[model samples]
Target: MSTCPTCSKPATADFAPFCSERCRHIDLNRWFTGAYAVPAVELDDVDFEEAESATTPPKSDDFNA
Candidate 1:
């Protein structure tokens, strides 16, 4: 059996990873308050422009609908 992430107690069927609703709420609060975050590399303007251009379709001069 897995232990609750918030309280370290035995996990219950009602909350597979948390012992109780309070613990579950505590985990959720952490997420809402930015306690957990996904790491990302910052891109500069040049990198952003290159990525954007690579994905953008080229403009066409044809008049066909």
Candidate 2:
């Protein structure tokens, strides 16, 4: 019922979203070659400081104890 994402043909049972092995491979090649990218949100300065503090070790006045 659904169309193949690569060729726009009717999708097959084996490949589901893709029409055939070739089409599937084409889509895979795009991912392997960095053709597709995942989007990320930019972190603010406040968020960066909070993350840094979480990983930093605590200081103690009595280091010898």
User: Per-residue lDDT tens digits of candidate 2, residues 1-65?
Assistant: 99999999999999989999999999999999999999978889999999899998877855757
Shift in Å, residue 54, candidate 2:
8.4
lDDT (0 to 1) per candidate: 0.92, 0.94
Which whole-number lDDT from 0 to 100 does residue 39 have in model 2?
A: 95
Per-residue lDDT tens digits for candidate 1, residues 1-65, read 99999989999999878999999999999999999999999999999999999998766754353
User: Where is model 2 poorest over a 10-residue stretch in terms of lDDT?
Assistant: 56-65
Task: Give the runs in model 2 whose Cα sits over 4 Å from its true position.
Answer: 51-65
Clashing pairs in 2: none
Q: Indicate the residue-level lDDT of 12 in model 2.
A: 98
List TM-scores for all candidates, in order.
0.76, 0.68
